[model samples]
Target: MRLNYPFFFIFFLFFINSTYSYSADCEKPIMPSDAEWNSWIQDIKEEAYTEGISKKTINQELDLITPQKKIILRDRCQPESQITFDEYLYYRVDKSRIMSGKNMMKKYKNELELVANHFNIQPRFIVAVLGLESFYGKNQGKIKTMEAVGTLAYDRRRSNFYKKQLFAALKIIDMNLVESKSLIGSWGGAIGAVQMIPTTYLESGYDFDGDDKIDIWNNYLDIFASVANYLTSIDKNPWSSDSTWGREVIPPNNIKDIYDSLKQIDPKGCGAVKRRSVPKKLSEWKKLGFKKINGDPLPIRDDLEARLVAPDGIDGSKFYLVYPNYKNILYYNCSSYYALSIGILSDEIIK
Candidate 1:
């Protein structure tokens, strides 16, 4: 799976709770006295030492230990179910974000290009991810990652995932990629301008700026490029600049025929991710009575393997013919609806 990319904290929890022992129910709230905090801090330091974390790192992280509501609110505020696409597109993808991205593009053009060229991905795509993730760092999460991860680790609903993230965060400290004291980020552990979690920092982040540290928080170049490289590592073809990330289309009434034809083929990652290998193109979709939202023929790409995706259920208002690259965007965030927002927003930004 893509590791809970939707809210980002869940994936963060996956890594955050690996080694922590639950103390109490976080919501009921037992304000650990200064002495108690100190005791727990020492215990945490011992755990870190056992895990090979340095004394310096443990001390640095322990220095900042006051609790805040921001982290708890993030988990509690997660939508009970997926918000409808209309709501997501209307609220999440706004003109302000697109304008901000354009402004940032102009400001950081040279740096973004260099990073994209080095990473073999598009600068716009990287920019889109930044905009979506944190509005280009406007709201880079505020919770101390160690604390947030620790809280979730103790929550038990996703104890295992949070524990792993906690372990990974410790590893990050040990690696010296980021300092343990530098716990500035999303309500989750996503740090820096691009807002990568510690685990993601370990996996996809790099010091493109040659600053001797992969410091994405302070450096725009490192943050921008690291986000691009992360996407490329997962699937390079999705980074191609030429393609649109699927479109809202109108499909025929009898869409089941196409779905049935594709189901006979047992596929691994693609279908599970909603990428059905429909061996057709614009021409076939048109032939099957598909029409563009604007009531015109879709521009043809005969050779490409296209999938008929109704992001809403079959009876929902819109139909989409998603390409494999669009599926790759879904890899960026697992929800079909989330992917749809990014795809549509990207097209708007580029256009």
Candidate 2:
């Protein structure tokens, strides 16, 4: 029943079909006419009513909704979609972010430990995710959640997905989880310090601080606990407290051949999971010439399996051998670039 989905799916889902840009020569895209927009709003209201949202809430919240051009444009031109893996990592996991993450770790040492102990997630990782998502609560976006999600739901690209998110946002308001006036978040409708989409918040958010409200926006305790809880929400590969996310690996000279031979298809999960190589035991990978980034031998563990992920490709200078815990992080954001940044940041901040 949890509707929380990998946020990266939205980026990939939209980018899969077309790439939009803001160049001067680029033709301006068409917007829906008022009449068209109104009809869609009417249909959405009926659907919301059918979905069991109170008539009062629907009438108050959806009456004046309109498609937002800014939200549509923001969705179309995310920087991660266009950048190289190195470039993306460089910006996402920079020195400033690392230092801030460390400070946050110290500042919330006690609270983080409690959340970590309760949820069995690494404290540094919780810090890393929040740091990346909203700069440790300093910048959790200001766009009105209803308006942003409504716009996305109306847009042709990823309409079904956003429609679900829009309704989830409404449900939150109807449940009195967060008031309509204060329901603000990212252009993509991701709320709070951890940048959870409405569906994710509804499903995984917790009132850890016991304030009677799950305030991921301002409460650090709730934010930390919510993140830890969400990370461990994956049932098949629940986070392993005994293991770390993954490490950078030095691949064999014939990594391309090795990659082709070892690659296996995943029919389930998002497109990101499908792009990674099949999981192989650490021992098997070691025998095939995979080593620690520092040229050390991989841990002698035949029991553990890891998947080789080269976001840039075999030609890229860096490669990672990701463990199951990495997939847990992927539940938050499906992209390897995003997950790797969290992994590396988690290590750096703790050091």
Candidate 3:
């Protein structure tokens, strides 16, 4: 059908306005000029060579590296770190993840048990880490690992840390554990089902299946064993299956003064570290009027020392008498919210 001239003109104007409005709303991120990016890539390639990366691998990977503005933005706007404890827990330890973790526990019962027995780590905690890290391997991220690390290494905000990771990633490729182009992971460069950074992968990843390749991306055995190994490795503090992560407690009225007297500013650790009460024997806490959330007597072991932690501060939320095992969780991910969610989710999975 032939359109009228007036109608055609009106339709053309509407299309143009809509297109321009959308473009304005979704403007592209500003990035360095091509010449600057190219020069940076060349410098990275030279550094990689001095660090003993093969010339062929450097050319194949570093030559094509480009700045990932999207990743830089993501690093700057990490919503998880900014959210409240309750909000973080609600999203991270929801019903679906608990159910999925339980199903995974049942499905991998034998393997989990074997790894647990061998490493003296709890099977449920292993499963919880897997669920939290990649949703039972359902979402291991889609960004190329090399590109993400390389971009962050050049971005200058945390260059020293990301550069270390970038070099470790190069070593991973050089050793042929995974091909550079095939390695995909989070925007910050954490890889595999357990979301391990490159340094951790090199230090603790194991070839559990004895297939000669530590393929955490595809092998559940490797993933589970690797996580257990990381927690129980000799260099790291061994996880004690007999001890729990912590118990929620009610502190005495003078807890604030007590906390102030004992608190140490540990800037290198997680948020929980800032609020950690001085370590006291379980009996001392009980004597000082702290009790379990359910009002039960604290354990009578004088040798068992624990720090009282109130993640949302003492007045706003439940307090916990966190044991060494709780700190072990922080070794995996320093966020107290992340560690608490894993512990809570693991308990549900076992139930």
Candidate 4:
């Protein structure tokens, strides 16, 4: 999801791609020479074989790999990278998507409840992620997984990170989890209904149906369970089913300076938005005049800590007091806009 392009270059490419279109002949604008590309593949093959990938897989999958110009272009032109929070929410959490998610939850109620109970994750959260990632498997992407990962591995900007993913993808093929030819995903190598990267799939995938294979692409049970397992996985920040992601609130005018002074720049890869103040007990925020948008008192739980986030700046119409569960959603996708959309969409589905 995160590629290490220089920040300025990313904005420059976005600007150029938005302003103009390349002709078909100019589509592949940049590529290494054949000799150079072949040598890189040879090196990858050697490393793959030494790591225990079968010779057949190495020869069949790696030999035919070529730079996927389309993937590089897609990576550089992500609309979500440039859109406003309101625009992002409108596009991703529309009425149609909410309706589809509701139907999906109703149709799969028994299975969803089973997985939710087993994993202690909310069913709505799982369904929301499914809807956001692939429209409930209706658009699981069309690019070949190996080809996409291989192309990024050779692109040089984030080669080392993507090379590791390429290896993980080959191991998936070697284990017969999915055939090399049938393995498909997004331009960045995220796969299946949940759009997990190869490393995430290997780490948290579950065979919920007990068929002995984790088929996130085709099996609804496995897909749901795998998603739940991932959020609850030990390697991730812990998710608390006891808390909601966040609540909309109104801050008192007298507290403006305190809130403004608390703002901080988000770490790289977190998102472009400014982060909120460091967390404090919910009780403390209540004493400072934060209240629910409905004018109710803030929750009186002494054990809970939260941060105030106003995505469009302090004067923005939307303001939220977010909890740890909100941060957990960020692990699934780093963007605050992305996490907020998921939370709002999940709430709509539950309603």
Candidate 5:
């Protein structure tokens, strides 16, 4: 065959330009010096004051903090671990985690049931989210919340997001919702057993036990209720008590071809949702050769609709027929891997 040198050269140029663009986006900028950080903090305080945060709260929380450059570095280098869905699931839904989840479910049975009744959500799922986020409240985070959010707010990328989080953290302090000294959490500023950010805590955190505090850190009642509240309050499609998130399945040998034809025509919601096949009745999926993992036929019903998701794509080892409730889990954490882990863990917790 004759060599297409010109075509290869053009492809090389395109590849080089794409790589450079990606590198440019990921490149880290210089960390701010102490003087620069102090000045930035002053500006932040002024903004917080305008947002109605108390002056005392601003000075007390914002004054003594130093920039956490390590957080910014971690944020910039947030690794997208290159692994298959099975490998991801292996670590997230292991034997120990499942056992711990079961134990937590039993230990907090009354509280979990209360939240379940109040929010119309399953108790197992609430436990699964808590277990996954903080390992049953063992590792919520060690970083001081103000310092972490403040440092990230000062950084360039995602400045607005972290800034909002910082103000919310300050507001939480101002309201005396949580003690300032106890306000420590993840490097990214998510707090408490359920690992909610400040804004979410403010909006959804509940005083379920009626101590007049939404103490997600040490209060399993608040934590469980908050998770249930977040799920039930998701706009449009909320969690359905009658259905589970999704189930594992075996797709047809021609799944790729089937998916190409049946994939969502109008991409909606997040990129994850867009990647899934359009909603087909369980009967329809059964007709198309999809079956439960145990080789049982899908329910022979047209009333129920489900979307097909091969998170690792058609060639991967697993596939799911997810329900609308699955999208509610996505609202909790968008990734298929994260949502799937929550679902599988929840299933195992009750088993």
Candidate 6:
């Protein structure tokens, strides 16, 4: 059985209370007048009616939308300086999570195999990601989806993303798959076992339980299937055995960040090198002092181009040999650190 979020309703009550304490300054401000609050609700009603979101959905969602402080903090915060990849992964990949993930692998085997068959995803990797994202659903987060979306829309930092997510959250409630009280998620709006944003959940989620519904919260099979389907939609199952996401080493002195000009290579994901072009065959890299960590032949051949990235960079202890399939990890997240962590976690679990 999949883990269900038990406190989702409590979070909702808090959010509903936050709706009226309209302080514009966040840190220090006065509450909006009754007229202003009513006007805001009126606007929401108008949008709900026009957009086909039911009145029930609008009322329920609005009732649960309290302003959250974390959203404001995340929206306003600037990017911090870089942390070491090893340190990042230390927190990201750990023993207990992987052990729990392995158990889930056993518990959900039949459904996972079914999803893997259709999507061609390696089940271990998917399960590893599941463990990493939400602790196998033990902690899906407590922030109300409505509040986070509303906060983001009002904040104006990445308004397009937040607004789109806001619309998607309302649509989820309107569809009746979730209650407003049940729409709790990460501070950024990722929900349930898969950590999917509301838009992604609505766009591509699946129902493998044969319930005629897609529920990411209560159905383990459906959640795994949805995630597998999402991965396929992003890359047609680029992580399959025939494909390679691992990278070949690059000589530190020889390569420039040419991949910067190669965004056209991805359908939506970035190239292996972000904006740079991929490297040439193993033979090419070998000629350039790029050898395998195992002292064996580099996995890639000379005929193919690979993304050259070292999470540790040139001065670091380890190097990454990237393949086009490896670039597919970025579709899950754009960060090289994130993708590498997933790859490494997948490796650790598989081993």
Tens-digit per-residue lDDT, 1-351, candidate 1:
233443553343344344433323335434446686577556666776787767776676656655445556556544333434665566557899888888888898999888888877667777887777777777665667788776665455566676666767777876777766675666556677777666777788888867667877778888877777777677545455556567777776677665566442555564336444454777777788788888887776576656776665665676777766676666656777666666776666666
Model 5 spans with C-alpha error above 4 angstroms: 1-29
* Clash number for each model: 16, 0, 0, 0, 0, 18
Collision count of model 6: 18
User: Where does candidate 6 stray beyond 4 Å?
Assistant: 1-34, 77-81, 235-239, 247-277, 299-305
Decoy 6 TM-score against native: 0.79
Q: lDDT winner among the candidates?
A: 2
Q: lDDT score of model 4? A: 0.79
lDDT of 4 at 143: 82
Best-fitting candidate, measured by TM-score?
5
- Look at candidate 3 and tell me the lDDT of residue 236: 49
Candidate 3 lDDT over residue span 46-84, tens digit each: 888898989888888787777888877666543211345
TM-score of model 1 vs. true structure? 0.79
Q: Model 3: which residue pairs collide?
A: none
How do the residues 283-349 of candidate 5 rate in per-residue lDDT, one tens digit apiece?
9999999999999988898878899888888678899999888888787777787788889999998
lDDT per residue as tens, model 2, 1-351: 222322343444444536644434233447899899889988999999988999899889998577788778766654333566776666668899899998998888999999999999889989999877877888777889999999988886879999999899999999888878878887888888888888889889988977778889888899999999989988888898999989998998887776777767544777567767888899988999999999999888988989988888778878999999998888888877888888999999988
Q: Whole-model lDDT, candidate 3?
A: 0.76
Candidate 5 has an lDDT of 0.81
Question: Better model by TM-score, 4 or 6?
Answer: 4
Over 277-308, each residue of candidate 4 has an lDDT whose tens digit, in order, gives: 66778898898888989999898878998888
Judged by lDDT relative to the true structure, which candidate is superior, 1 or 5? 5
TM per prediction? 0.79, 0.88, 0.85, 0.87, 0.90, 0.79
Give residue 231's error in model 6 in angstroms.
1.2
Between candidates 5 and 6, name the one with more favorable lDDT. Answer: 5
**Worst 10-residue stretch by lDDT in candidate 5?**
1-10
Model 2 TM-score? 0.88
Candidate 5 residue-pair clash tally: 0
Query: Judged by TM-score relative to the true structure, which candidate is superior, 2 or 5?
Result: 5
Candidate 5 residue 244 Cα shift, in angstroms, is 0.9
Error of 4 at 37 (Å): 2.2
lDDT of 1 at 69: 54
